[model samples]
Target: MIEESGRVVSIEEGAVWVETLRRSTCSACSANAGCGQGLMEKLGVGQRRGYVRALTDLQLAVGDGVVIGIREDLLLRSSLQVYLLPLLGLFAGAMLAQWLALPEAFVILLALGGFFAVWWRVRGCSRRGVDDPAMQPVVLRAQLAVCAMPVEDR
Candidate 1:
């Protein structure tokens, strides 16, 4: 399970809306100083904050801090859907276009068309909730200011 801390924004019966900081991994690598990812991070190219609708069993309230978790398997599958399929489509489309001896411009267009076609299908499948339960995040536990352990034992 992958976990992150978030603060509850709203409660709706069985779920809670939480807002968390969108962490960037660019800084973790030694090559970040000259990498395109580091440049994008410096420019704030992506979202700074992220929202999650997490299923919860606890009595959570607005403004409460909580830990949300997502299954690693689900994350892996989602990564593939977002990254791999389109790549395969691009290669297949390019090869088909070459085999047919199409013009250079048409080849590029067909490749892009193939990528978008697969992307559109992925979007539709997600909207139809093909694997929502596995993809959805779940609230793990409430965050506490202090741990239950006694202090000054050292």
Candidate 2:
């Protein structure tokens, strides 16, 4: 259950809009006073980005915690369509071209297309966390702490 928080920017016609915050952990840095990462977070403070999604039958308020995701079946189908099929197509095309004495240019183009197709799909899929309005990783695991608490001597 990934989670991210946002202020509902709008609700209209079976859709919800939200303005989200980027997740950065500059506050805990030991050198925050001189760190570039800390500076960026501070400079970008209070900035908001918008996300819009079709409202589902489930009741959701404008300010609700909206966790969106690619459903498991959708993900599975995408993996097959985007990755495996493209690879198989490329290999089969390359071999068939060799066997049938097809032009080298034709074979190269098909193989390149297949490779690009897979590259594009993988890039988008991995960044689902950045672009998807519904899926948030923060809700799943943010607070399993490390290190022991300090003891107060009596």
Among these predictions, the greatest TM-score belongs to 1
List candidate 1 stretches off by more than 4 Å.
Answer: 32-47, 147-154
Which pairs clash in the backbone of model 1?
none
lDDT, candidate 1, 1-154, per-residue tens: 9999999999988889999989688878899998998899879885478889999889988999999999999889888998998888887788889889999998998898888888898888778874366668999999976658766765
**Error in Å for residue 71 of model 1:** 0.5
Runs with alpha carbons beyond 4 Å of true place in candidate 2: 1-7, 18-54, 58-61, 113-154
Clashes of each: 0, 3
Each prediction's RMSD to truth:
4.0, 10.3
Best by lDDT: 1
Can you write out model 2's per-residue Cα lDDT over 1-154, one digit (the tens) per residue? 2245554556655455655666577888889889887887889863557564533444455566554433565556556866786687678667767677879997887777756766676667767755454442222211223569899999
TM-score, candidate 2, is: 0.42
Taking all chains together, each candidate's TM-score versus the true structure is: 0.82, 0.42
